[model samples]
Target: MHKTKKNKKYTGKIYRYTMLVFVISFLILNSFVHWQMQLQKQTKEAKATYTAETMVQRIETYLNQYQTKSVLLKQIVESDENMNMVKFETLADFIIKGNRALRGIELAKDGIVSEVYPVESNAQAIGLDILTYPARKDYAALAKKSGEYVMAGPLELIQGGTGMLLINPVYTVGAASEKSFWGFTILVLDWDTVIEELNLDGLDDSFYHYRIWNMDIRTGKQNLLIEYGDDGLKDELLVSCDMRNDTWYVEIEPVNGWFSTTEFLVNSMICILLSLFFAVLFLQYAIHRQEEFAHHEEMMRAAKEIQEANEVKSRFLFNMSHDLRTPINAVIGFTELLERHSDDEKKVTDYVKKIQLSSNILLSIINHVLEMSRIENGKESLNEDTESVKELIRTIDAVFETTSRQKNITCEYHVDVIHEYAVFDMTKVEEIFLNIMSNAVKYTPEGGHITADVTEVCEKDHKALYRITIQDTGIGMSEEFIPHLFEPFARERTSTESKVLGTGLGMPIVKALVELMGGTVNVESKVGCGTKISVELFFEIADGKRAEESDQKQEISSTEGIENLAGRRILLAEDNPLNAEITVTLLEESGLSVDHAEDGKMCIEMLHQKEAGYYAAILMDIQMPQMDGYQAARAIRKADDAYASIPIIAMTANAFEEDRKLALESGMNDYIAKPIRMEIVLDVLKQWI
Candidate 1:
């Protein structure tokens, strides 16, 4: 009797569990169906929003293309040098050539398209009436009226769907609007291109239908310009344009965006329910917590492994750099010495050039590494201040004057000094001027003129500021490279082929600095012509308007610290023998008094005991073992007796320019470098003396 009762109890327990599972499965499945329907509805609304925005962006992109192409075409029509009948004939030839070259630029003349770019399948459009055409005629008329820019709303084609056009009126030189309207330049674009690029195919397996509509909410023109799919599911949108410039871009564009996807939700519900069902079966309530703990531990172990590897990588790079710089410096320095002492003049010149090239490479690697460190450390902060226009320009001129003269390129400077001072970071200003000027000189073929001008643009609000325009008659850049000019590690099409290519960090650095200083950079160029870079800095009227000086005769002579070092025998307090050797070489070349002291203690001993006129200055190294330059300078400055009068200049391998200022601020007279330049030593001496 007891055995039978126990069997019945076991059967009842099994029955209860099976019934419970059945009931739960039924409830979950029904709930999933309801949730999927809601998800589809939400997807539909999201898709609608995305579609609205993406459509706007597509229209804007096409409009921009139209505007640019129209400008190019107008220039062809209106140039005085190209207005003759033969030139016009040549222009027609150019039109054909350009059309064949580019995918999206077309040219129309006298209401007839002589050339349509790409020479696509449609040849019937050639010699057709562009004026009477359904797409371009209206925009051409507006261009005639405005003489500026005219954009058309999206229009539906009589044959099928939607299109858009932009027009600009091209005028001849001094050509009256009535006489020189030169038939309007029309830019035609099809919006379907955007749809083709952004459509989602293999990513989603659900019902999603996407369509794009321009945000012509203002123009009252809601012509459906693009549609992505024919599925009944809600559409998705990726990007939209009617927002803030940076945030204005729409992503998860329409048609694939928040669109009703009943199928997607149903599938998702199936996944969630399946997950819960398995979770309940395999995982007991107590074991579920234990499984979570185990998963966390596994993740932590993986994370720890990655962290250890990263630490090792970091150490490796650090050690590699430390090891590499020593050999590199030795190679470069000895190579320079060999080139200098070489008997053959040509070989000497070759070696000298090679040394320069090698030094540039070393400098590039250093800058890249240093830049990475600075970014990681958050140290590249903008320290802005008001700077003098004349001083700034003169400093820039001093830097590039020799190079410019070498190329026989006369640089004419026009400074609107009346608006004298600008509130910007001086360091950044120097960088911007130097980079642009260097490129201008490098790119402008020999003998080309470079002009840098600053003018006060009259503002409507009675607030006037400075406009610094640096225009070079150098080999200008291609239109394609313009967008990427400011990207780091990006060399232009010309830059790559030219012998003057740099580390490619200059322009990006310039842009970052300018933005930090609250300024903007503008560029315009034509291939084979020249490039003009106009940088507009926000200036506060601090020093009053200085005059516009087209030419300034101020010259930066090869400095020897000549005056500062005059009769001042500098006490060379350096511990490193290699650094001491280089210092002695540069000092002798600059014609200065340099007395060697092995370390800071020796420096103090020599200064304490030396005769009154034995030393006039001390070029201290900041990181000496016995005592650093800062401490030595402070001790010398604090000296009560005769030694206090002698000046100390810190010579350091630290290339941060601010370090020099820091040395001076710490009671030192000036600072120079370890691998010192003869000119710099001379300049420092002249200034201090």
Candidate 2:
């Protein structure tokens, strides 16, 4: 009996241990499964949000292209109030051919369709009155009343289809110079074509169901523009974007719900098997934790990067505001002073000089900002041309001559280049040198010494590497700040506190332009002693023919004196009356007669009516009403008259190098950037005429 009782006790112990093990395993498996499900849910949410954002971006981008095209049409119509069928058809054809999403472009006069491009297919749309149509009238009236582009549709077209319409109102100047509504420029985009271009249908078929929709402004009801995949989208993610006057929403959801059933089942089976061995289950759990930690680290890194970008942008804006306001304030204050002391000639002269200095500062800031933007956008490029190395060094020295002399600073330039002429982007090279030398002059105190050394370091494969080192005895930078010196909008605290006038974009632009040319820039500085900057750039060696050609061109560009401008009559095409008056006054004061035309069209007409050789040259402004300078230049070049080849110089505020290139390509003899200096004007005229 005692033996039997002992055996029963052993059996009871075994049963209890087995039950405890099973219970613990079940609990562990359940917890792991729960964790996995939650992870899957989070992943789906992130993916849905990302997909919705992507869809919105794609839709907005596609629609914005068409909207921009419509605005161009509006500009054309407003410029030429008498726009005929041929011109309209030509412009429309160009736009449509460039963009495949466009179904047709139409023009409406007094709310009636008067013209349509691709006339054979959209012939029925002609003569249709959009004002009388119930489906289109509201948006058309909205566009006319608001004087902004209005988006409408997925409505049936007169040509028997469905499409979206972008309507832009056209306004023209009446005889009294008052604005009057001309009509509308309408752009039609087929829905299916846009969808295909944006890959919306592919997204629906691949993994997620989506809906693109908007709220009807008139009805205050949900209007579905596009729907794809399943009927029901549970727990959908929605994102909204604004286009012109409308708000568009993109909603997305996984087709198989948030969590995949097959993945869940597979995970559960793996977890159950792991539970049989506690150590294996623990290892899996640890690995999962490690993966989660890694993911969190990645997310934190991304967040940090985004935060840094925002901070940089904020700093740039702050510096821009301060820099821009300084010169503007000076200009305004000096102008007021001049007006108050109008009768005092000395005070007026002083104030005018100050205003001119401030204007120069303002222009410098604007140019730096534009240059930085071009660098950031990867739009800056090298326009390699044959340039004299010696001339380049001399130019930098000449540019800083006055400033350095006024400061009592000694400037020295050393050149050891073997090749007299080499192919390089002369403009960018000049910009780099000027920027460096300007800073040196601005920072250096009186009696400071500055030296520039240029040497041809090596030559191989028809390329010569040139090294330029500029050293200055100035208020140098701290070693810590040297690392950030090439960053955009980076400024030293000492410079800012001293009220130094700069946009803080010079060094950054220099660095970008250098790197763009496959060059290197380095800086070394001491706290109170001095600073040194070194740059190395490669240039292609120019052959004898190129060097000879460049020398000939340079020789032709030189002129005798301003006296040569006497007795010359030139046509000035400027839209702004104030600018025209200023230019005319300046030219007349220099012994030249100036005839002013209000716009490009008038300029062309005046040229045509005048006898050949009556005008010495033409000064054309780029942005004008009726027609732009490019159009005018081309028309003059194509004219059947002796004066058609007359010298035309573009004088405008489109001051980039590309603008100058375009002006020359448009049949202009030369270009002069505005906020014009009289010396430059005289030099250009001498070269061309």
Candidate 3:
């Protein structure tokens, strides 16, 4: 009876313990499954964020490249003396081929579609007036009015396809804020091509949904530009892009609403083993956290670098504004005063001199900055011509003589050359000497001494090496700063140098110019002692035959020998009314007969109407309507008329070496840059007419 009672109590205890273990296991499994689901959700969100961000970056990069191409086209058009329709068409075709999204490019002159690329395909768009068209007028007006790039819809097109159009307005800036709208450059992008390039259709399988909304300035509403996947997703990641004059928003989310099939399977397999599930889950969570921290750190570093670059750019702009405005303000103020006091002879002379001084300073600043930019962009090249070495030195001395006298500084120049002439770019050589000498004069204290020395180093095989040294007695620089002297915008930051007015571009430009000319420059200085700079250059010695030709040419270039200019008939082709009037007045005052042609077409018509050799020469402005100077020159060259061989002198504002070469290539006998000097015009006339 006692043994039976003991066995029954033991069995009851076992049953209770078994029931408690089973209940605990069930509760633990439920918790594990819930935790796994949460892990899966977090992984999916992370993946979606990464994928969406990557796509956004890619899209932005693509758009930026296209934008760059558009901007380049605008620059080309603005810089061209005459816009050649054929050349523009070629450029457009190249762009379209390079970028699959671009369907066509169109150019408008004052709202009229004057040119379009892929003529066979886009012939219908060639004559369409952008301002008069109902579908395009709004965007065209917006772009012109805002003077900024305007992006318009994936709207239905006249060519039976949908496309997005980006319109950019080109304007010619007049004095002050007065802007004359030049025209419009249009970039037409196929909507389907854009979608494909952006891979919007493939984003669904990539586990993300995307929606793009562009704020329409016209409607004052946000219109959907593109959308992919379901809009009903609960969680979505959003990114905003600031386009010029418009705002665009891009929203993205996971297709499965934060649920991931891969993560679910991974977690489920681990959960089946129960014991290993917790350990593996914890390990994975730690690893993921570590990766996230690393990614955050990398992002922070990149952001910091970008911020630093932006800060540098801001500082550069500040410096440029201050430097550029100083001389410009002086020029403007002095000019206004001179104009008002024109009646007083003595005051007029003094004011005019002051204005000229200020103008020279402003031009110096502009030239330095532009030269540096050209050098950095690898566009700078030497245009060599036979020049007298002594003549060049004399010109330099004349330039600085007055400045030195005003400052009471002793300025001396010396040259020792075996040959009187050399094949060199005289303009570049003058710049090299003037920049260095100017620096010396600027840095030297009042009554200090500045000296320039040029000597022939060696001569071999018709090439001569020349050494130039410029020394200044002024507050000098430390040895440590000498190494960085050739860097752009690098200046001594000492109190003694703080008040000095400089563009900080002189030394760098000098260095680049010297290097470009196959030369070397060196500097020696001790703080408070003085500074000395030496440059060695190689120049080809001009042969006797070329030298004689140059001398004969120079003789003909003189205005003194010209006695029959009054009998010469000249045709001036100019578009701007103001420019035409000024040019005509100047020419007539020089005792020459002047006839004006409003455009290249008119100029050609006038030439064709007149008898052969009736006009002595044609002074052509490069930019004109109906036709441009280049095309006119070509047409005249091809004409059978005797006047076709008459001198065509290109008077243009495009004043670059490349411009001169192009002018020559286009059959122009001579080229003169505008802001036209009467003296130069007379000289050109004396030579050609």
lDDT for each of the candidates? 0.61, 0.81, 0.76
Q: Write the per-residue lDDT of candidate 1 for residues 498-530, one digit (tens) a residue.
A: 766455555776676666656789999998889
| TM-score of every candidate relative to the true structure | 0.34, 0.39, 0.43
Ranking by TM-score: 3, 2, 1
Q: Candidate 3's residue-wise lDDT over 1-689, tens digit each? A: 77567656655655555455445554677578778667666766666666655666666676777778788888887666268988997788777886877888989888888788877767788778888787788899988887777778867876669888888888766669676888888888888888787865554445666777876655667788777775554677676766655666777777666654655564455445553444455445444444445578785776578779989987666445533554455556556556556789998887676666556555655555556678778887777888888876766664565567656799888899997788887766666776687778777888899888889999988799998899999888899999999877778874364566665666777788888888999999998788999999989988898888767765654345346577688999999999999999878876788899998999999998988878999999998999999999999998887977999999998877788898899999999987787767887877887
Runs of candidate 2 exceeding 4 Å displacement: 1-369, 496-501, 558-571, 575-619, 622-651, 656-689
Q: Of models 2 and 3, which has the larger lDDT?
A: 2
lDDT score at residue 139, model 2, on the 0-100 scale: 87
Q: On residues 576-631, what C-alpha lDDT tens digit does candidate 2 reach at each position? A: 99999999998888778999999999998888888889999999999999999999
Comparing 1 with 3 on TM-score, the higher-scoring candidate is: 3
Can you give the lDDT of residue 153 in candidate 3?
Answer: 82
Worst 10 residues of 3 by lDDT: 318-327
The alpha-carbon deviation from the true structure for residue 375 of candidate 1, after best TM-score superposition, in angstroms, is 6.9
Better of 2 and 3 by TM-score: 3
